[model samples]
Target: MNSVLINGITMTYDDTGGGSDSAGSVLLLVHGHPFDRTMWRPQQGAAPGHRVVTPDLRGYGGTQVVPGLTPLSTFAADLAGLLDHLGVRRAVLCGLSMGGQIVLEFHRLFPDRVAGLVLADTFAQGETEQGRKERNDRADRLLRDGMSGYAHEVLDSMVSPATVADRPEVAAHVLGMMLAAPPEGAAAALRGRAERPDYTATLPTVAVPTLVVVGSDDVFTPVADAVFLHDRIPGSRLAVIEGAGHLPNLERPAAFNDALAGLLATVRESARDGADMTES
Candidate 1:
């Protein structure tokens, strides 16, 4: 893990260390709530000849844990700061769930810095009153009971029943991530997430090549949400991984990687077209 001073904290990340500034050159993977950079380990080498950077958000993994609310905007800003620190001018951002929302926020705030976008198992709409209450209540419960019970309860939902039955190792990895997450960090994230703004308007404005992916069985943010995103984002591609759940990248890494590979190919083609036009 590479540590850097970004946005006043010692942010930690994994960087593959070398790649050019060409299309699909830099891939930044953002992990979702209650998980850290290691969640992206399977994807680090998926994109050959690219720099794959995975970072732990403010309160997760090896990063400094600030025991208070940390907004999505703050997370986005930390990513931008990290890019600056690494001398990267632009990157293709890939995120899942809460991480996807943070990627949207990053695009909203720093559109010029985004070369492409990959949003998986996430929705664009803001929270409803009931949803907000549930998240806050969950936050309180986590602070009170810690993560063990919550991790146990959510395990089946995070992955699918089939995954737990057949892929015990993947299930264990998911559970381990949840159990290892700092309660304070997870609580603050829940509180902040409860206040998230709708990215409904942000989708249509995406000018870069985008890919919207979801597990067909995702209960948190279903395949319908991915279709909704695909419908809104002009020229975006939608991929539904069959038989997987919220975390398809983990439940079905091969399919997810194939979808991502397709997106990277599209991005490269677009870049080449642009360069040819400039050269002409």
Candidate 2:
């Protein structure tokens, strides 16, 4: 629940120590749209020996929300400012859903600052014209009818039907997070997302080690999307969490954490090798 003024907004973030004597590489976890940093609770202590930071993207959680259409660059700039404020020179960026898109934009803007990338349940393509219309229409609905009905409407797609039926607690938790989101902020993000650039061309240029994770049953951003990213990103690895949906990190934290641990190991080894080369 820490707050810092970054990019002219009071951004809310959680900073957990990297359990190492030296300043270790950071693991910055970004949340999806309509959800805040709390969505990353399961991953907080999971990355021991690495600084774990989870921030509520502007307009969500404890952070101040600006009115009108908020671009993804605004979110990316907030992250850059946050890292500068924290004195962190580089970090491994992990993001989910809309958060994933932000990570891509961040890399595009600050490639040298990224040690690695983990994109979960997200896509690199921009929205189609019809998709944009639907998103805007949904935004209009949120402005008019509010979040209660909209939360329930999108709850089924956010997680798997199995999660809803078998894991009542997880389903309820996701619903609660959505219902608690500020309608205006959520709508603004939806509108902003509609205008995101096509990042497909940017994937192949990613020189850092990358990991693409997706739930086996994620209808929203299907496994196909993950495969698309893995194929495009030269050396990227893909992990499919069986039986989970869009929010696999919440629905199946253990599997998600394992994949993340593997990515961290690769990034750490790469950093060590680079340092050794420099010293030699």
* Best-fitting candidate, scored by lDDT: 1
Candidate 1 stretches with Cα past 4 Å from truth are none
Q: Residue 207 of model 1: what lDDT?
A: 98
Supply candidate 1's per-residue lDDT for 33.
88
Predictions in order: lDDT: 0.92, 0.91
Model 1 residue pairs with clashes? none
TM-score to true structure, per model: 0.98, 0.97
**Model 1 C-alpha lDDT per residue in residues 1-280, reported as the tens digit of each score:** 7899998899999988466866668899999989999989889989987888899999999999988788899999999999999888889999999999999999999999998999999999999999999999998998899999999999898998878888999999999999999999999999999999999988889999999999988998988899989999999999999989999999999999999999887888888888899999
Q: Give Cα distance to truth, residue 26, candidate 1, Å.
A: 0.3
Error of 1 at 240 (Å): 0.6
Error (Å) of candidate 1 at residue 49 is 1.1
Write down the lDDT that model 2 would get.
0.91
